[model samples]
Target chain A: MFIADCQARLAFDLLAHTWNPVLLWTLRHGPARPADLRRRVGGISPKVLTETLRRLEHHGLVTHRRYREAPPRVEYELTALGRTLLPAIEALGDWAHTHGDDVLAAQDRAR
Target chain B: MFIADCQARLAFDLLAHTWNPVLLWTLRHGPARPADLRRRVGGISPKVLTETLRRLEHHGLVTHRRYREAPPRVEYELTALGRTLLPAIEALGDWAHTHGDDVLAAQDRAR
Candidate 1:
């Protein structure tokens, strides 16, 4: 049990990334095409956004559904597993809302 | 309001990283010296562990207090803001516990 818990913890760390919050938060608002995700998830480059989405989709945290329209739209949305992770994301947001100043202060002290 | 939220969201992204979870999880168990952290956070090299702890300390998520006796000792603990983020971490753990299988299945399908 302990070993399993440790491995689970490690897996969670593997999923944590610089762009994850943006990817998840953007999806939290609603489903979006890859291009739209690039725009909505500001500060992310096209390459990085593409890579992030692929990782998220690969992990089943996000699903990609393609449309056979003229330009070929690809929409990304959280799957049931992805949705299951929402509370963690939302909880993060709540932490930021409440303690952002302290975090900023700590950053300032470090500099 | 929206823009501030966006920046805050961005900052949160900046904080998320592969080693950050391990660092935080190590501290979650309790305060420890850098050496101890390296041991507890499996698969992390000393260099990465050192860098991660510095970043955590810089961000005020963790603090370092040094003692000068014999071999010397330094302890790291989460700040109030860091403690404030615990619920989110615990929530992530809870999410993994409940939905780990689905997440894994999603990963398998992607392959």
Candidate 2:
């Protein structure tokens, strides 16, 4: 049993946003520039992506580095803390892969 | 990499709600009446608890049974499908226990 303000609830809050886990998962492979991230992630506007990145950075799950190159490259990478969450995310993914249809079927039955 | 509408996303959506996982966890022990759940869970309004239970039932993660006794009694229990999610929830809980302080520190640093 967990209290409403428990630390576990904090972790859940971090994942409550739709894009947070998605962006973290996207960054799992390695660092990538925002443009590359946009192309890879798909359907996210530049504005929302930037906002989400800042949010992740604020939470210390991600960090950014800027290169003083011709076009000024900026790459986002997961911090060690961020990497720690990957397995849990993968676990959720596995559960979805296995039981997603059941959940959908349940939804249909309710409807 | 998950697409916007991936099944994995569906699983994340289920966990995105704050009380969903908490209530699911509370009922993990066994069938519990609504009043008992309220006392165990704490701080949740009877209305919100009712709504969350209905949501979980609609998702097929939980089921309810009614007894015709001196006073009618209703108990909520997790379905087999719901039981399957316990590991994933426990995994999240473990992560929180191990790394929750780090996350909080990060938040403090950001502030």
Candidate 3:
């Protein structure tokens, strides 16, 4: 009998969000500031991105460096823990790319 | 600029639901009846399981067969496409098992 407290549930919950995987993928190259994230991850609003980043940070998957000199600068990067999810998410993305058409075909058949 | 109509989005959307992955995992061993699914997956209501199975079937992940005996019987099994997701989901489960504690610790720190 499994409840929501399971580790797998937690991981699934993190990936459940619409933008989390995309956000993680965008950060794969390296750290990026908020403006750059906005440009790269496209279609996510500034407010939503802030919220998502905060959630990821709280989950230990992302870290933000704040340079408190002159005009403060902040950049967000994936923590080692956060980077662990990249391969998992990429595997899923690959599966989706390769076999997603079958799912769509099934949907059409059901319709 | 990526939009909602992508394959990755579709895959993420499927896994975003709490029980979809679990239900799929439960079906990995072989075919089972609805009652067995309820007992194995635990905590999922009958209605939700039906909905989940229907969605998975629509997505071409599961198939149900009925036997027209004196006592009718129904069983659900994972399709080849459904089997494809098992490895991906297991990878996520593995990541969760390895790093879930870190996420919990981060949550504690955020508080």
Candidate 4:
């Protein structure tokens, strides 16, 4: 259906980002403050990290909770929908591990 | 494993493209000549389609066979590894069709 195409496109687009894994891996264990997530997903700048989180939040893949304190504390966590994608991502990881050689060979053949 | 991460990253990166579905859908039914594929994947420019096919071929997701004739004929088809990805794409499509509401709800909550 048209809606299915939209959803498929969205998921494919979302998972395509280099930083997505960084963000998902961070949330895999549990929620964390933005600073900590930035640390965990090395090589990401504050601007890029903030943008990535915002996009994830926008897509409903992650939740941002802001604490009311002298200095605001914001944390990000995977929502139920995001959690559902974990299995797929993990499956992809498994496939990548088990079939990397084949993929590499295919890559060579195509080249 | 290290190889898995690389493959996972590659697959994720490859699937992220908007044109990937268009290309795969074309190849899903059967092998396609470049011109026909370009026509089928509406809204795509010839250059972009060429680039996409090149990338797919480079990644071993597509195989391009050049025919010697009056006019050069380059036909593209899904390789074995590329065919393996069809199920994932179809699964995502089914999930999107059935669970779009859920994903939209999650999006609303995150906003």
Candidate 5:
């Protein structure tokens, strides 16, 4: 049997990083060059974006592809396994949309 | 309409904390005292567990209750809204189960 704590903790660790889900969600549509990703995901620095992409690629969630040319074109896309996480991410988004206000309010009170 | 980027980012923020989901998942069964939580979620310090519980309560995901006994008793339980997060968290867990090895392997390669 899958250990609930270990399995669940694994998922938590995966989703716990700020940029991981955002990058994954950003690529939900399809592959894109770094320039396009930077444009699409505003507020992220190029350096940070590069690091996040590398992590994602390292995790097998995204692939790094290079197109040969004078100025080599490179792009990133979510792998099939990575695609499976879209729905899971969406479920989280749905929860946030429905109840994020309460959380914000609570945070406000705490502060 | 919920902006996909903003909505998705909100979810990421909520789930991005290492202990948030773990604490939330720990209370899946029912209410528990801090001692029980610390026991169930091994490796977490009492201080950190308390902090996590406070955050979850602040987020309106968990409720704090106190008993009117001699020493006084305090316990935590998931609210109705908090329970909603179970499936979402589970969805993430499912993804981890299927592909977490790939992520681990990739991390090892990067190391």
Candidate 6:
């Protein structure tokens, strides 16, 4: 077990935020405009999405590109550093896919 | 990316709590009495540790055994279901070990 201040806790802190991994996974497909991201990701408010993206960007997990088109299109994409986290996220996703029912059942038994 | 209500979100929810993963990891070594847990875990208030343990018990990730000898003792250990999450947690830990400095650098740059 890692100590409370171990560097590994940093990964937990990154994943602890409700939306960070979600947005990171969403951006894995390719660069996406904010509106497109909102649509694809679903249920997240524009404000929260923006905040999440800014947080990801601040951590250098993601980067944004502004296309100076007629209306100034902007898009977000994962950085190489950001791409490194995909396997970890996918591992958790795979676990959930297989055992989510078990967890739900456990929860049900508890209630 | 997974939809907001996807099963994968369950894993994220499990990990989102700051101390859940920490406690889970601690229990991975073996069963320990609550007091031993408090001493080894360090800095966690007794109340929060109890709450986190109960939450893990409720989720079927952990089980407790009570011994009625001497002063009476209870030991907590991870369930089979709980053990399944170790690899996923380890994956994140490994990632952090490798890339935590990068994240710190990014945060520093953002500042």
Q: Point to the candidate with the largest DockQ.
A: 6
Model 6, span A5-67: residue lDDT tens: 788889999988978998888888899999988888778999999999999999899999999
Question: Please, what are the lDDT tens digits per residue for candidate 5 over residues A1-111?
Answer: 123357567767777777788788889989899998887777788999898888787777899789999799998999887787888888888888877777777678768
**Model 2's CAPRI class?**
medium
User: Which candidate wins on lDDT?
Assistant: 6
- For candidate 4, write residues B14-98 as lDDT tens digits: 6667677557756887788877876666667889888888888777778877899987777889987777777666655565666
lDDT of 6 at A61: 99
Q: Give the Å error, residue B54, model 6.
A: 1.2
Which digits, one per residue and each the tens of the lDDT, describe model 1 over residues A11-60?
Answer: 45534675765577678767888777766655678888888888888777
Name the lDDT of candidate 1.
Answer: 0.70
DockQ list for all candidates: 0.45, 0.77, 0.64, 0.40, 0.57, 0.84
In the predicted model 4, the residue pairs found to clash are none
Candidate 5 segments exceeding 4 Å error: A1-5, B1-5, B109-111
lDDT per residue, candidate 3, A13-76, as tens digits? Answer: 8987878888887799898999998887667899999999998988889999999978889999
For residues B1-107, what per-residue lDDT tens digits would candidate 5 score against the true structure? 12335756766777888788877878999999998888777788888888888878877789988999989999999988789888888888788878777777767
Fnat of candidate 1 = 0.44
Candidate 2: list runs displaced more than 4 Å. none
Measured against the true chain A, the candidates' chain A TM-scores are 0.84, 0.95, 0.87, 0.77, 0.90, 0.96
lDDT for position B9 in model 6: 86
Model 2 chain A: lowest-lDDT 10 consecutive positions: A1-10
What lDDT tens digits, residue by residue, belong to model 1 across residues B1-111?
Answer: 122245456345534565675567668767798777766666787788788888887877888888998888889888766776667767777777677777677778878
For model 3, the local distance difference test gives 0.87
Better of 1 and 2 by TM-score: 2
Of 2 and 6, the candidate ahead on DockQ is 6
lDDT: worst 10-residue window of model 5 chain A: A1-10
Candidate 5 docking quality: incorrect, acceptable, medium or high: medium
For model 3, what is the alpha-carbon lDDT of residue A103?
91
Candidate that would win on TM-score? 6
Ranking by DockQ: 6, 2, 3, 5, 1, 4
lDDT of each: 0.70, 0.89, 0.87, 0.70, 0.80, 0.91
